[model samples]
Target: MESSKHKHYHVHDFDSRQFLENYFSDKSDMVFGDDTLKFVIDNLKQIFSEGHINGDILIDLSIGSFIHHLYSACEFFKNIIVLKVNNRCIMELKRWVDERTGAFYWGHTSTLLQEKEVNSDHFEDKEGHLRSAIQHVVKYDLDKENMTDPLVLPPADCVISDCLLDAISKDQDDYIRYLRKFSRLLKPGGHLIIIGCLDTTYFTVGKDKFHVFTFDEDFVRKALVGEGFIIDYCNVKKRTAVSDLIDYKAIMIIAAHKEK
Candidate 1:
């Protein structure tokens, strides 16, 4: 259970399964998967189709409990690593990946991917590909000095982080600091793909609230440039005001590469 007063500051007690049910459910997914998510998936498809995005290791930093964000990464990488913030999310993700009896159904992601001209058509085929591509699903902590310690993982050729920073960081300063930490996981010349909600203060699930650091496109681009990244692509999609999930101005998607 999360304290209603401090839910904004607590990360470990975040509900993984409830998040999946509220946001990533096949029913709820239709709202996002069709519109706002379209921009993100479209940009990914463009680079992949243009032969600009492909590599051995593609890392996704936590991405909360939802797995649909990595659906595009599966086609471009030989190995994909899904990093999580806690074991609860790990267990929830594993349940879906392992095809457990009561796992949250992921059919909607596959359905959306199929409509995008992705290489795979069959839902099982896409799931198999994602399952095969994912080599690791380890825990990550933005508060840590070294996000990963004791066990060293391979530096990624590409990293895809979706709104995890806003979820974990308590403020703009922490967000920038953790962004630098996440950048260290990439190899020189490696690509970083980010999808975030702009100007969000908080999002709720059930009765509990979680913090989302407020940021605009200029701040994100400026921060990444300061970290010595070359911006390849950046775009924002305005929310259609359909769901009451959160109050955010828009969805921002950015693709940048570290200097070699």
Candidate 2:
């Protein structure tokens, strides 16, 4: 027999140790605002309304601030799954879901940040199927060294890489490798959502330097088209604010994938 009462579980994970803190830190006051939420919700609504995610699987690769989006998507879809490759982010996600009810599943995430190992765990979960029936895989890559092989990567209905592509890759070749990998991760007509800041320099996590690519919107748009993802929509949100008594401005890009 099992208890059927909802318990208020206050679990916090390490997955969000980097991004969440940054988003809520003094520096974030200069970067993000209410418009960011509106920007994300609008894309979500567009995707969900298309009936693309009704019964489909969604794999949230990095599980940054977007975990909230998945929590909300659970209200519209019967099944939603998130993959947290980092132990820090996984803990944060569980904390976010502690007392919430939704149609979502979580995959295995270890403290080890190895793609091969994580992919192996995903494969074992798949058990030999060429494609897992999971809704989608939102792959977020902040560490470029881990963008190894997409052919071996798990299948996802849609892919959301938010400001991660440039953050991970050091050069265009590396970036192209990831874009190609993303193309292969989805079906011919699968959707890809990319949101990123343009002309950004670098971000730090706990004294470690993390790089950001100059996300040229025109260049990315052309690249996505070449990669075979149709441009369903494109929106750029600009923000200027004061954080830590300093002023900063940022430009963000949102693009939708086209059906094949």
- Best-performing candidate as measured by lDDT: 1
Clashing pairs in 1: none
Candidate 1 accuracy as TM-score: 0.90
Candidate 1's C-alpha lDDT? 0.76
Tens-digit lDDT track for model 1 on 211-254? 77888899999999999999998878888756777777788888
Candidate 2 TM-score versus the reference: 0.63
Candidate 1 ranges with C-alpha deviation above 4 Å: 1-6, 28-31, 118-124
Clashes of each: 0, 18
Which stretches of candidate 2 lie above 4 Å from their native place? Answer: 1-15, 24-31, 50-54, 63-66, 75-77, 99-154, 206-208, 244-253
Quote the positional error of residue 29 for candidate 1 in Å. Answer: 9.4
Q: Candidate 2's residue-wise lDDT over 85-158, tens digit each?
A: 45555545554355245312222111111132325465342211212232333333434444432423545566
How well does each candidate superpose onto the true structure, as a TM-score?
A: 0.90, 0.63
lDDT of 2 at 158: 69
